[model samples]
Each structure stands twice: as C-alpha cells, then as structure tokens.
Target: MAGSIEIAGLGKTYREPVLDGLDLTIGGGVFALLGPNGAGKTTLVSILTTLIRPSTGSAHILGVDVVREPGAVRQLIAATGQNTTLDEYLTGRENLVMFGRLRGLGRRSRGRADELLAQFGLEQAGPRMVSTYSGGMRRRLDLAASLVTQPAVLFLDEPTTGLDPVARRSVWSDVRRLADDGTTVFLTTQTLDEAEALADRIAVLRAGRIVADGTVAELTATVGGQRLVLLDHDGTEVRSIDTDGTAASLDAALGAVPDAERALRATLRSPTLDDAFVALTQSATDHQEAVA
Candidate 1:
C-alpha cells in the first residue's frame, strides 16, 4: 500500500533541474528529509503542498494526487514554512481563530482556537498580540495554526531554523506529541540533530536526489560500526580505533593499542548521524564530479 505521502519519479526544473527523478514513500510518522542548502527540499515541499506544480512525476497526500486534485490535497495537508505565517497585530488566539474561520469552521473556530492554544501550552500567551510573543511562542502558535483543521499530514520546512537550544527542544517536543497523536509529520531540515531527534525515518538528499534513507541507527551504520577511543587523564582523546562492534574486533583493537594501561579510560562510540550524513553526501558529491 502507498504511504501517507508518496512521490514517484518526482522532478522539478527551473533553468536547471532542482529535483531529479526523485522517489520516496513515507508512512504515518515523523519522516525527515535532510539536506544542505539548494538540495530541492523546499521545492519538493512546494510540489507536495500544491504551491507549485512539478515539472514531472506524481505526488500524493493520502492517495489524493497533488497535481490532479490540489484542492483535495490541500484539505488533507497543512504546511508551516521557515517563516512565521501568524499575524503580528492579532493575538495568538486570534490568528488561530482566523485560520479556523478561513477553513470555514464557523462558530467552532473559537473553540478550536482555545483547544490548540492549550495544546501548544500557549494558554497564557494566547490572549497577547503575536508581536509580544517570544520567538518560540510565535513558532508554537504558527504550528498550532496549521493544525486548526487537523490535517492528516503536516509539512514542517525547517521548523526550528533560528531558535536557541531551549526553544528548539520545545518545538521538538511539540512535534513529537503531534506524531504520537498519529499525525504524519513530513519534516525537512538541514540540521542533523533535528532529524536524529524527531524523525522515525530519514532520507538524505544530495544535489537533487536522495542518496540515503533509513532509520537513525541504520544510516549511522552505513558510515561504519562502533569505534573504540582511548582518552587521556584530562578526558582528551588519545587515539580512536575502528571496530566492527563485535567482542573479537574490540579485543583485537585494544590488543593493538600500545601501552593501553597508560590511557585513563576507553569508551565505545557508535557512528552518529552526522558521520553518516557527511560520508553519504561527500560520496554523492564525488560520484557526481566523476560523472561530469
């Protein structure tokens, strides 16, 4: 069966191809598209959200073709871009209620606004003008506005781009709660930490194509297995030895370390998403250069 968000042979071109023969399938959960700048992440979101049509290929949200039935697709999905879409002059609650009314919620708009304000932990700030809200608060309100209609799929394009660590984690919690509630969140971000923290599955886009796709552990394993690191008394890394994460491999690595007792301690470290991302994207770049 097709996933909640499906793309087949997806391509988009402007002067040059931004997305090339892309294909992806995301089931109901937090699915992240990770890539560097100009990797066609926003282009894909635009196509899927019906903001723009693709040059080729098909995209569907919950079985509704975005190209053929954009109106239907719009009803099933909502998107929050990098910039806030809330009205600064209006109260947080007012912004949500406005969105609700735009969605034709009628008298239920206020009720839904209250529900979202409370859900996003903005009950206290809901009555204040958006201009007075903190960056994090505004972001939460923007997200809440997107959920006023309870979309099946929520597209978040770099949801936490310019926030401090605390604020980013706050948004991360909100996203987790939404996914837990069965909302299929399609998140696009360049930050590896964000993807590692939020995504149930991640696809790495390089240039215009997906180079890797898998769970966090799976992608990390692609770069390499566990590593054994020797640390000095000051907690500085003395040496790093690569291992296959097996007992025999670790034993061999340790046996090869000269004067191992001199080291204060040793630790096993697994390959992180950052390692996988750098390795995968660099390999893609090398391959593209060779092809050219």
Candidate 2:
C-alpha cells in the first residue's frame, strides 16, 4: 500500500534547532529534498522514518503517527542511509536471503532473493561474495535488501551520491520502477541533476526551514521569469540571466557584458530548476543576512 506523508509544525532542537516549524504534505510519487549539508534534509528523513523523535508538532505516515507509534510506522517504511550496511562475507544472494528472512519472509525468502537479484541486474553476480562487488553493485544490493518487505514508503538518502553516470542511471531506473509500482519515494540528494531528473515534486530546505517547495517548473516560475542564455560561437563562454524581460532587467543583464552587440548568439528560455534553486536559496541567505 502506498502512503501519503503529513508533517505539521515539526521541530527538532539539539544545540540549536535542526528543523524548525516545518509543515508539508507529500502525496504518493517521488518527493525529493534538495539541500546543502546541515540543511535538515537528513534530520527530516530520520524523523519521518521513525529513527528520531521530534521536539514539537507531529508527523503521520499514512495516518499513522510517527511519534506516537513509531513501531507501526517502521513496519510501513524502509530507509537506506548514506553508507552501505551489507556484510562483506555474504554473497549477494545470501545477503538478500538473510534480510528477507529477517523480515520474516521464511520459506518465501529464496524466491524474494532471486527476484531482487534479477531486478537489480545482479543475477550473474548473485553467488559472488559481496566483498567482490564494486561500489555501484554494493549500493544496488543495499537498496534491493531494503525492498524485501515491500514497504509502503522508501526513504533514500543520497542514493546515487558517489556513483558514476552509468551506475547513477541504473539506480534512477530502479527508483522509477519502484514509484511506478506504487511505493512513495522520499529522497534526499545534494545533486541537482538527480533531483530534477527524479522528483515529481521538490522542496528546498535551508537553515532549518523550507526556502522553497513545488514542482520543478512551479519553483522555477516563482523565482520570477525567463532566462537568457548567451553563448559564444567558439564555445569558450556561456552565461545565463534570469529576468522578466523588462527594459531595466534586460539592460542590467546586458550591461554586465563588455560588448553585448558582439555576442555570437543569445537564446531566451524559461528558467531551469537549477536557476530556481540558486535564486531561492540566495534570496533566503540575503534575508537572513539583512536580519542579522
């Protein structure tokens, strides 16, 4: 069963507040959390996954209160952290089988193990010791192990952080397939490309608050207007400007260039997700700076 997430006025405090007054609702699909280090991305994940308690407010996963009944919430979700946790002594198949049994699959464990092995493209490597697997392979096995119980929600923290392009794409495919099959995916990533490619909706967290949250296009539009891409014919220079195309805005953009009339080409385009992220985060920073 897929689930929706509801967090209301959630706050966690340690030294200072890690997460403060966060209120958000995430329905079924890929919900990506984009943030820099210490931006409360992982903290939010931990609270949602029942790994930690909130100091104030409440959160519910599929109507189950995360704080009031963490055990029940745990039964409905699986989380994979930044690091791998597989036993190197075990073979790929053995690891899956072990995890399946731990989840109480019992006699069905072997079949589930085979299914995951095939699903992750590890059928040929299933019998090899996990120590022999490469980084990407190990990550895939770790993810596959998490799915043994087929939880309603899956939290993947930095799932493809260290992967090469090919391996990253492979993980992307698996995530898409899971979401297609009705598992609500909550992802945290520092990679903008990963969030843009995978998230059906994204929320950018900064300084213990959500600076921005929406679909990629919606967030981009909120930052104001179209972007002008200026590229040199020799491919030596590329600059982008975000503006509403007002006379002042256009002039300011052009003024930055030494000779706008001599530019080889310029294209007026809609702002990308990257532009929205940077602009919104910068705006938040500026606001905090002014207050300080």
Candidate 3:
C-alpha cells in the first residue's frame, strides 16, 4: 500500500519552476518540510490539500490522487495556512460550531465546538469574539476549526509564524497530541528549532528540490560531527575545530593547539539543525550552479 503521502515527478511552474521534479514518501507521524522562502513549501502543501493542481506528475494522499479525486482528498484532510481563517465577527466557540455545521455535523456541531475549544485551551475564551482575542488565541482557534472533522491528514503551513515563544510551544503541544491520536501531520516551517523540537522526520527543500531528509540527528550528521571550541577569557570563541565526537579526536585536536593555557575554556558543541540546513541547502545550490 502507498504511504499516507506519496509524490512522483511533481513539478509546478510559474514564470520559472517553483517546484522541480520531486518525489517523497511520508508514512505517518509529524513530517516537517523546512525551506527558506520561495522554496515551494507552500506550493507543495497547496497541491496535496487539493487547493491547486500540479503542473506535471502526480500526488496521492492515502492512495487517493489529489488531482483525480480532489473531493475525496478533501474528505480525508484539512489545512491551516499561515493566516488564520477564523471569522473576526464570530466568538471562538461559534467559529468552530460553524465549521462543524459546514462539515455537516448538524446537531452535533455545538458539542464538537465545545470539545475542540477545551482541547485547544480556549474554553474560557469560547464565548468571546475572535477580533478581541490575542494573536495566540486566534491561532489556537484556527487550529481547532481545522479539526472539526478530525481529518486523517492535517497540513500546517508555518502554523506558528507570528506567535511568541509560549504560543509557539502551545501549538507544538497540540500538534504532538494530534499525531499521538493517529493523525498524519505534514508541517512546513522556516524555523529550524520548530522542526528539531517536533518533527519525527524532516526534509529540507531548496530551489524546489529536497536536499536533505532524515531525523534531526541524521540530518545534523550530514554537516559533520561535533565541534570543539576554544574560548578566550572573555568567553569569545578563539577557534573551532571539527571532531568526530570521540575522546581520541578531541584529544588529538587539542594537542595541536599552541599555548592551550591561553584559552580559558573549551566546549564541545553538537551540530544543530540550523547547521545541517545551511550546509545541505548551500551544497544543493552550489551543485545547481555548477550544472548550469
């Protein structure tokens, strides 16, 4: 059987190709797509959510072709874009209830609205107009509305773009809970830390192609192993030496340092997602330039 999401030779173009020939498979859990702006992250999400058709190739969500069976795909999935889709005129509770009604929940709409409001920690604000809510509150309500039908697949495009740290984590917790309940989440984020904190697996996109795909540790390894930093008395970095994260390698690198006592301290730093993202994307760009 095909995975939850499958793509083959996918391409989209406007003026120039926004997405080149791309293939990816995601089975389940929270799969994050990380890319800089204009990397086609949103374009891909738009394709999968049935909002737009690919210029070429094909994609499927749970074996339903996004192009051929858009209605079927819509039935199985829901999307929350960067902007909130909530109505400012409606109360938080009313917004969710309205979504449920549109989804044909009928008499069950009110109950489901209350349930979702409570799930997203918006029960107290449920009766308040969304226009009066904070940015975080509006975001939570938008997310809640997407779940009115409990979709099998959920697509979040930069779900926490403008929220503060606390609000961002709150959304992260909600995403985790959804995955735990067996919802396949496809997340697109520009924030490296968000991918590190939440992704079960991550793929980095550059120039409309995937340059790296793996777990946080796996991707970080692509950039190389840990780094040894020598710091001055003022705690500024004097030098950084790459290491394989073994004691032998650390010792060998340290031994070559002249006047080691001049350094006040040394620290081993693990390669982060940011490091991997930069190295991988830069490599891809360099390769493309060479090919051209």
Q: What is the C-alpha lDDT of each candidate?
A: 0.88, 0.86, 0.89
Residue pairs with backbone atoms closer than 3 Å in model 1 (clashes): none
Model 1, residue 66: distance off in Å is 0.8
Residue 107 displacement (Å), model 1: 0.7
In terms of lDDT, which candidate is strongest? Answer: 3
Comparison by TM-score, 1 against 3, better one? 3
- TM per candidate comes to 0.84, 0.89, 0.88
In model 3, pairs of residues that clash are none
Q: Candidate 3 has what TM-score?
A: 0.88
Off by over 4 Å in 3: 238-266, 283-292
Candidate 2 local lDDT, 1-292, one digit each (tens): 3238999999999999999999999989999999988899888999998988999999999999999899999888988887567999999999999999988899999999999999989999999999999988888899999999888999999999778899899999989989999999999998789998999999999878998888887888886776666777775336766668687887776665556544557767776776677776666666334322
Winner by TM-score between candidate 2 and candidate 1? 2
All models, RMSD in angstroms: 4.5, 3.6, 4.2
Candidate 1, run of 10 with poorest lDDT: 283-292
Encode model 3's per-residue lDDT on 1-292: one tens digit a residue.
6799999999999999999999999999999999999899999999999888999999999999999999999999989997558899999999999999988899999999999988888889999999999978888888999999888999999999889998899899999999999999999999999998899999999989998999998999987778777788788777766678888998987886678454458888887777677677776666334322
Predictions ranked by TM-score, top down?
Answer: 2, 3, 1
**Regions of candidate 2 where Cα sits further than 4 Å from its true position:** 1-3, 259-266, 283-292
lDDT string for model 1 (159-232, tens) is 99877898799889989988999899999999999999999999999889999999998999896778787787
The reply for model 1, stretches above 4 Å from the true place, is 228-233, 237-268, 283-292
